[model samples]
Target chain A: MTSRDVLFAAVGLITAAAAVLAVTNRRVLHAGLWLVVSLGGLAGCYLVLGAELVALVQLLVYVGAVVVLVLFALMLTRSGGGEVDTSPAHRWLAAGVGAGMTVLLGGALVAAYGWDTREVAGPGNEHIGEEIFGTWVWPFELLSLLLLAALVTAVAVATTGHSRDRAA
Target chain B: MDLPLAVEIILKAVVVLAAFLTLPLAIGQTEHKVMAHMQGRLGPMEAGPHGIAQLVADGIKFVQKEDVTPASADRWVFKLAPAVALIPYLVALAAIPWSAAWVAADVPASLLLVLAVTSVGVFGTLMAGWGSGNKYSLVGGMRAGAQLVSYELPMVLAAASVAMAAGSLSLTGIAQAWSWWWLIWQLPGALVFLVAAVAELQRVPFDSPLADSEVVFGPYTEYTGLRFAFFLLAEYAGIVVMSLLFTVLFLGGWSGPWSDTLGPLWTLLKAALVAILILWLRIAWPRVREDQLQRLAWLVLLPLALVQLALTGVGVVVWG
Candidate 1:
């Protein structure tokens, strides 16, 4: 196999491992940490696909912002560092559901699509920029508004009547 | 014989490795000296001719120091966090156009690529916090996440204004389009971008995550030795990256008065000047409260950036 193939395999393995860690880890904080690994591996996959922009966004938004916030919320609420309780019933049910969904999705994907190894050269950044600014301006503006609204909501949620709790 | 792609790749890799290896040491020394002067103290004067070897000494110290993991920490995640943090900064270096033909990888969407890579660095911080299993670290990581996400909107909007004006997302293309740089025409966008970029990098006045007095070193509180050093290096690298982006997107990359004679050197000079300015700001300013930071980003900067976007849209339609 070519070096590229080996690299892809490594990335895929790491991603799978991270996903498992995220789900199985008893500590909520540990789960969040595992999420970073999974997302980072996904980003590497994007890089290998030459979707540099998408990969970078994956790093910046998912890894940098979303997961950090999740960890922050967890820390603020939790008293100390220890493995969070995960009862056997919940674990078994989650494992079963996860396995079933994975199989179902895998089967559907394999049935619907050909396993072509051909590479596709997608549109460049300039083209995307043109399309975004020229044709997709309204949606772009809406996304900004949505983000603004989310920011406001976050502030409201974070700063509400739990001032004493937060301070503590 | 036609050289194998592997050989070419190795050669390029070496050059990049050398540059990365050297640049940080130089930049760190510069920062120490500058910070010293700012504080009215002689910094690193004893190391090697005005503290030239100061960074090298620091690097050695970090390496020699014991790398520790708290017994309560998740061992694997703790080990991985530094690499996660360092890689984003390194990958970001690929998209930055240092000079004409100087970019490591001139991806079609260089600007987007940079934003994306830098964003990933946040995950590293998050991982460090979470994996450390420290309350302070987790709180710091969360604050960083919220702060970055909130500010990212204004940052993207500000960048979009330039992309709209330049009509391209390629850093090189943007630089080339600067018959008159976008910074002058879109001063408001430039202002917003600079502010947002600083916040995005989690620098002072906006570094609620590392508010040492408050958060007790925030996400990095649990880290020590080389791992902690990596985080510090990543922060400096981030500052360099943001300064370079500002130079490229708005300040006209390497375009300057001495462009004809100085060439790429002129660009380097300009970039260094911008980096120094950022460092100066870091020294001069105090940290803003977390709530105030969010409020400023959403209520003030975001709206201002939107207005800038509107103005650009008008300008584009009218001028085109």
Candidate 2:
């Protein structure tokens, strides 16, 4: 394999390993931290693919913002104690869903591209910006509105909780 | 890579690392001496000729002191945290232009990459707090994480405005495209950037995470010797990086009267000016309440930055 292929393989492997660790880790905080590692590895994969803008956005959004949120939730709940859920009743269902998704996605991919090995040119920020604001403008705007609604709802819930506590 | 290109890259990395090591000493000493003078007191006059070698002495002392890990600490994460905190800034220096053609890495998405990588430093603080098994450290880390997250939004928005005007992510491109000094047209955005930058660096007034009086050095309470030194050095390095970024984004980076002849000297001078400005604010301002700090970042700065970004977009379209 070429050096680029090797790099991509390495990153993909790390991402997979970290993803497994994130899901299986006993400590909730450790799980969150592993999620950061997984996301970071995915960002590295993006970098290896030459999508530098996407890689950076992945780092900024996933590693920086989302992971921090996860960690914050863990800390605020005081749930860093290494207790883990040991229930296995849903294991088969989870496996079935996972397998179904894998098959569906793999089939879609194979049908669309027929196992082709062609390289796609890296879509830099300029092209991505055009796509987002031009053709995808409505969906992007709707996504932002959804985020704004979530934020407002969060604030409302917090304020109501505070008022309820004061009244009590 | 070709042999010469490989050699060049290695050489650039060495130069950046050397700067990372020494700049903190110089900037720290400058902060000490300048703050002393501002307060009409002598600062570090004894170490060697106005304490020029004081930081060197401190470095040696840190090296000699016992490296202590807390008894209950998580060993691996605690050990890895400092490198995580410091290495990103070192990598970031590669993308910063010292002069027109003097950048180590001139990638198209470099500025964004630098900001993204540096944000990962928050993980270091969080790791430090969590691994130390100290309640105070955990609280400190959480505060820092929240503060960083709040401040980053405004900073990114302000930078987005500058990127809109420049239409490129390369620092050199931004510097070259500024027909008028960006500080003139983008003053509100620049102010937002500077405030957010200061908070990002966790300097005075915004330093509740490491507030000695309150949280007992915040995330740093358990660290000792070389590890503590790493955190201290990382803070100063952050100041240097933020100053250079401000120079690149707001001030005309490496561009001044006769700057062509002066080369990187003008850039260094502007960076120094911003560094000194940071030190001035650090010494002058009293500590701000944590709530107030968050409110300023989210309530005051974020909207201002967003408005500036919109205005810059309009300006770019009309001017183009």
Most accurate candidate by TM-score: 2
Per-residue lDDT of model 1, residues A16-71, tens digit only: 99999888777777777778779989988877766666676787678766776666
Off-target runs (Cα >4 Å) in candidate 1 are: A1-10, A46-57, A79-168, B1-4, B257-261
Each candidate's interface RMSD: 2.7, 0.7
Computed on C-alphas against the true complex, the DockQ of each candidate is 0.52, 0.77
Clashing pairs in model 2, backbone N/Cα/C closer than 3 A: none
Chain A structural similarity (TM-score) per candidate? 0.76, 0.94
Encode model 1's per-residue lDDT on B1-320: one tens digit a residue: 56798897677667766766676666777888899999999988777887789888888888998888998886887788888888877877767887776777777778887787777777677678777878788778778878888888898888888888888878888887776635567888888888898898788879889898988998899898999999988888877778778888877877777675565675667778877887788899988999999999988999999999999899889985
Instruction: Give each prediction's root-mean-square deviation over alpha carbons.
Output: 4.1, 1.7
In model 2, what is the error at residue B291, expressed in angstroms?
A: 1.0
Candidate 1 has which clashing residue pairs, if any? A56-B116, A57-B116, A59-B119, A59-B120, A60-B119, A60-B120, A63-B123, A64-B122, A64-B123
Identify the candidate with maximal lDDT. 2
